[model samples]
Target: PICLLDTIGKVFEKVIATRLSAAIEAAGGLSPEQYGFRKGKSTLDAISKVVKTAEEACAGSRWRGGSKSYCLVVTLDIRNAFNSADWSRTLEALQRFNIPGYLQRIAPNTSMVGFADDVAIVVVAKHLAAAEELANAAVRAVESWLTVAGLDLAAQKTEAVLISSRKAVETASVQVGGTTIRSQRAIKYLGVLIDTRLSFKEHLEYVQRKASGTAGALSRMLLNTRGPKQATRKLLTSVVTSQILYAAPAWAKAAQVKTYMRGVEATYRLCALRIACSFRTVSDEAALVIAGQVPLRELIRERAEIHTAVPGRHPRGHGGRGAAGRQRPEPQEGTGAGRDSQPSDEAGTSADPKRGHGSVQQMPTRGYVPIEVEEATAPFAVQAGQAAG
Candidate 1:
């Protein structure tokens, strides 16, 4: 195979030299017919400098060479790298560093939108350290410039790995997969904009209507005992009851399978908790969707009781003993929870400890059972009011 040496540093040095030579010749260092340059010691010196700089950069990359270390050269193609628009602060920093306005104006334009507009940079570094640093710097620069232009940087993903070499450098090579790989993407939550003009009934209806359709379909599937539910039940039973939960292969060196089963059990517990909470606000139709015909009696006796502390159910008017929609015990008057019980204090009103409330106990009003007209019209009461006036 032929080798292509990417001598960016070399090219940069050569351009600098050629330009300098041209400038000198323009000032009459050599005649125009001599092309203002020649092949000599000076050329060799420039090449040597370029080679040394490139070597230093390569050394920084961290490759194991000389037939000892396995070498991996990774190239990261940044999807939408430039349009990431994270640069306003960076540009400000540059200004503080005295980068001129003209330079800022002439900075590269990133007009592409969506995933298509991302910038990609090809880096040649010897080790992971140098390669990642170079890639990160390039990414940051694109982000900063985009920020100045009032654009948002989209989510980005990266891939990197070392290529495997069989036998020797001159032999055929193939790709390899490692035991683990990690990747990340950006997410932004713009502020919620709720329109208050929608009537409470309208909002409730909107939610109920949305729930009906989804819940109806889900409920049907759960009740279809011969379908997915059967499969799920079998899976759960196997994990909980089978030998696989407690035993491993005869040749196994560790409890890898048992540990995995434990993980599955933990996940089931978490999911049960979520389902219990969701059942509270869900409409009857939606509740049926999730619970299906799985006899609530059996489920409560089985899965729902996993967390004894979490209340399973309560009478419509009865308050319970957990964080779930229960009336908290009223604290004594001067205590922290009761401090805001006063009506005159707005801070007390807004900071009411019952922040996540489904309902609150209303204070009793001054004593007044319904009054009869005959008692209400008593002459003494009328006379007293007139006398005071």
Candidate 2:
């Protein structure tokens, strides 16, 4: 009888759900910056904003307040974020924000502080020591606030990352409870690896490994099934590509990653050729034509544009490189990374005629005869690489 009554009671849940959400919003149950579980917003929005903030802070860390103020980002991993977010403590936090009400008011101490699971506290100060102290203060306050309300900080996972000028000789650490949190060169938050240098090399390598593994698995499937090449190609596009492109909108802003697009293109071309049983002499362009796969660089750029805020522009701050012009490292051989992709001042494409792999190749034209690049100079040829750098 109790089960039957429960089933019957749910019939009205639909009628009141909308009203319930509105009532909650009216009382400030959710902060504006919070996007989790909210309509018209996803975790990506939060991630993009956070990563952009990290980049800006990095720039400021290099040259803020007359060129000495660097920034520090301390990611606080509260063991069980949602499970531990006590209602009472949340209200107290609102009070700290002076969240416009008659009951209480306190000045907000942070420029950026909002997260349920992975909290990223952005501290931009003149010195590393000042930034470090600010970060620790947030932890202490939150730990005290949450502990009183039946939650505790996960000191084991909590760590700090300080980004300052390359030559800045400042180091700092934070302590939570008995746990003395140490600083790290790189830290993972929300599945993204952020380094103190913000190079994102680890992240690129991680995605490459994942995509490569998926591509290998797809290859195995091809051997077992007698299916059309289209099916295998679809699998590569949907699954393998997804693995490589996850969170690329924010991370791909690093120009050093541009060369990986070519690497990806090479991998796809090889996979397609094996299916067609094409000869080794076939060019990558021919293989891509056979597979109906879009150029990897184009694909990555399109996906990033779709998921992230403005591609090259920073979401905030005019002084920083923002996302588009963020970071471009000098291409060097032997690293197996991206090549020099500096574009001509006016032309959006890579200025140098050398295509994706950094190899100098003849750009085929209607009147021009086919010519192969000299083997000796092909591999090392760069697109005005040093002039741009």
Candidate 3:
């Protein structure tokens, strides 16, 4: 499918979108659970939330010494989401959120982390039946909302998955618009294959296959005797490697398993060997070093740390410096740098020794919070503050 947008119209759309996004953010019209098309949120954040919640639920069950816990994830498919959207409903939604009338005339545009039309509802419970019940209620709620919003839910394409650590889990299902959606062992959400145990084994295997194919294709064109130079080949290898590392932060833990690491390293080694123009017999570690490429494991860890350290994306709070602040090694006496030396802030200003770089004054307060907003009432809790002012 091809989408053609006039250059001028596209620029105008971006301007309008930016303005509308800022207004919505100020009023807190968006839910914290939402991660799509918003600043400081990504697929990694959504995946992390789901994985952590499922892990905690299963762990809680074991601690209680009773029935096992299960996490029910329902992914709903919407039919032609953008085309079917009701402009009137969107305008009304904006109005209800106390959005400026000028902005309401422009444009309108999940979670229960949605990216465009993809929406996943997650429910965790001690029993499978209870989990199913919760999932059914959530689905019904979504269906009703969609109906009112002039959208159609593609019940046939909807998928449900029951996440648990046990091998023999009783399959559970959810009812969606009179259609029964059975739970699967694994479901692909936002390009990542999430399985029952959240082990990400299937996802990693798929990545290895894809990475190997990409590297193999590039290798043929990048022969040692002819074709692209070593530097050019390495650049191409990095580009392909980045694709393989998509959502790496979410599945980094799974890479720790020896079996999983073996395949992943093999794929990485192939790319490294090609870049270094080395023999196949070279060790994976030596090949990566020779190519001046970071090991896959270390690369994944570094990416995960960066994701956590990013200001708005930090899981704990706004000011967390993540691994950078916590894990930075102290300077030795022989080194010119002092132990008390402070890192420069993003603005290039030297931070005070007493206060870390990410002090309260430096971190701006975020507009969105985790407070629940009932659809029946006016959305955007921040609207109250705006009204009072």
Candidate 4:
């Protein structure tokens, strides 16, 4: 579960209550900001409200000036939250804002897909909406591009969701298509504790254990009485969810996981574990960024070729030119050398007219065109050829 620090004192009160209460309720319940869907107020306005609330709460409190200045402890639990969402349409809407420089400089490539639908993007934005828009635009662009390329986009669902964080607010939520999901709450919750000393390994192990336990419980509930295949399928499903949800921020930064059109905080243990585990094997920031922004399938399909490039095997040679270079021909007949040997026919032209125009005739490799020459010119032609030779 994640916790958003609405106000420093309010969050502190919840933390203190952790020792006494078995059931933990959010300090001010869940905030809409947790899911990146807060509206009717600017970010600054929201911050001001939170700050004022904290000050009031701290006024006569024992922990310093709990009212004058309070710490909003937003905790993010990265264990099993759906941070990497499939909100293709939202991304498209955000991309319409077009902060290309930010995307290229920060965000790299993003590819998302579901069944017959797929979207791939190569940009990033400084804020969640921008990032979301880019993904949305890519989804539409990909859908259209694929359609033109003889593929389908609308035959299946394409979607995405993202999480973002700042010192003042918490956010999370789900989205289907391009619109913000307003009806659903997060299946799981998260709470993040900043400035902690716990090692990544320890935290990761804990999350893994927790995920395993959850999966086991679901498996038992659905499989023992439900059957072996159902049980096994649920196990795999849980594992995949765990894998995406549990990553080290070091490998890929956690998205602002949102649900019900708002943001929330995750446990510090979860955030630390994700960050720690993320940096383990992956090394590139671009790869990590894409991992955070897009889904697993589309990324794999779109980048498999580029990601698998080998030494001495040029990318253009393997396929064709990219956005700029001259395209290399594929291994098909009548395309390369054979093209130069054939003279394209013009519509409505007679054979004689074509021949009269001195157009090169496409002769069959097995046959030849025969010509008869005048005897008077033969001697002069022969003399000229002989002199040149």
What are the TM-scores, per candidate, against the unseen true structure? 0.21, 0.61, 0.75, 0.20
lDDT tens digits by residue: candidate 2, 1-389: 22333655455443333443444556544443444444454445545555654554445333534434445556665566544444454455444434444222221221112234555555555555655655665556556644555666677887666665566445568887777777777777566676666767776666666667777776766552455566545655456655555566666665346553545555566566655546558888887677555555655565454343232332221111232354444456865434334322211112122211121112111100111221132232211100000
Among the numbered candidates, top lDDT falls to 3
Relative to the true structure, how large is the alpha-carbon lDDT of every model? 0.27, 0.49, 0.62, 0.26
Where's the lowest-lDDT run of ten residues in candidate 3?
Answer: 355-364
All candidates: CA RMSD (Å): 36.0, 18.9, 10.2, 32.1
Name model 1 segments beyond 4 Å from true. 1-84, 88-149, 152-198, 224-330, 339-389
Model 1 C-alpha lDDT per residue in residues 1-389, reported as the tens digit of each score = 65553799458546644654444334433211111033321211221222222222323222354221222212222234344434454344334434445444433332212222312222333333443444344344434434444443334233332222223222111111211222211111011011111112222233234433444444444443344544363333222222211111111122223442343333333223233334334454454345332222223222212212222222121012121243434556555544234322211111112111111111101100000111112221110000000
lDDT against true structure, model 2: 0.49
For candidate 4, the 10 contiguous residues with the lowest summed lDDT are 380-389
lDDT of 3 by residue, 167-247 (tens): 686689889889888999788877888888888999988888888888888888777666777778877887567667788
Find the 10 residues in a row with the least total lDDT in model 2. Answer: 380-389
Cα lDDT, model 3, residue 221: 79
Clash count, candidate 2: 3
* Number of colliding residue pairs in each model: 12, 3, 0, 83
**After superposition, candidate 2 runs with Cα above 4 Å error:** 1-20, 60-68, 80-116, 167-171, 255-282, 306-389
Ranking by lDDT: 3, 2, 1, 4
**Maximum-TM-score candidate:** 3
Deviation from native of the Cα of residue 137 in model 3, angstroms? 0.9
